[model samples]
Target: MDPFKQMGDWKKNMDQFFGDNFWDEFEGIIKPNIPQINLYQTEHELFCVLNIPGLHDLEKIDIYADMATLELRGVIDLEFGGGQVIKEEILQGAFERQISLPFPVRSDKITATYRNGLVYIRLHRLISETSNKRRVNVRLLEDE
Candidate 1:
């Protein structure tokens, strides 16, 4: 009846066949939503926090905000010196993530900062006379 239920059953079978961490081992290749994020909003503002560790240079990260979208691009590189890895879990690679905002935001009124391995972004909601509704003037075009 449920197609997703069969998919879940297949996943369980695969996990049993390959081991519990089979999928996790391919995360770097699969590139699964790296640098997890949390978003919160208020009446006039939006706050977003991203979990990204091992950042040495801040210039590697770029944050962009538009009327209805927020995008982040960055790279996380951690070197462990020429050694064998027993178990790896942390994600480290170049990543780009775009998120849709709940409402329109002022592109010029956004600020972002990184502290303690967390990236914090603050955005102000666009509140203007034309924010909700605006009149568009139509002009007739004449063929040359």
Candidate 2:
């Protein structure tokens, strides 16, 4: 029995069972019935884009990140209803999406903005650390 050949066959079997959308399936188990998000990465930084339409205010969007995880939460309003009900394909109501980042991100230097119908956020990969020092003098008081 060849060990390398056996391992290769096992890998193919697992991939076939999971399919190409294994990540999507894994995310669904954790967060059921939530809006999907697309994440991209580069050598310098990470790019995240979410599909949220009918957003009235940009302030409504909230983004938070730690050393290893980046979380996104927001609400989207879908106005539907006229006189007749024919077909509905778009997802309505509020949605919240949370994604795990590959590397550590600088939370303070994070920038985000919402334009048109999509929310864009730019996260810096290599964060420069800054340090500041301050000195204070204290005087002793005498009691009479």
lDDT of each: 0.85, 0.70
In angstroms, the error of model 2 at 122 is 0.5
lDDT of 2 by residue, 118-144 (tens): 778888785556656556789899998
Task: Per model, state how many residue pairs clash.
Answer: 0, 0
The digit string of per-residue lDDT tens for model 1 on 40-113 reads 99999999999889888999898888788998899877856678754556877888879999999998788888
Q: Which candidate has the highest TM-score of all?
A: 1
TM-score for candidate 1, residues paired by index: 0.68
- The residue pairs that clash in candidate 2, if any, are none
Clashing pairs in 1: none
After the best TM-score superposition of candidate 1, give how far the Cα of residue 28 lies from its true spot, in angstroms. 10
Give candidate 2 misplaced runs (Cα > 4 Å): 1-34, 126-144
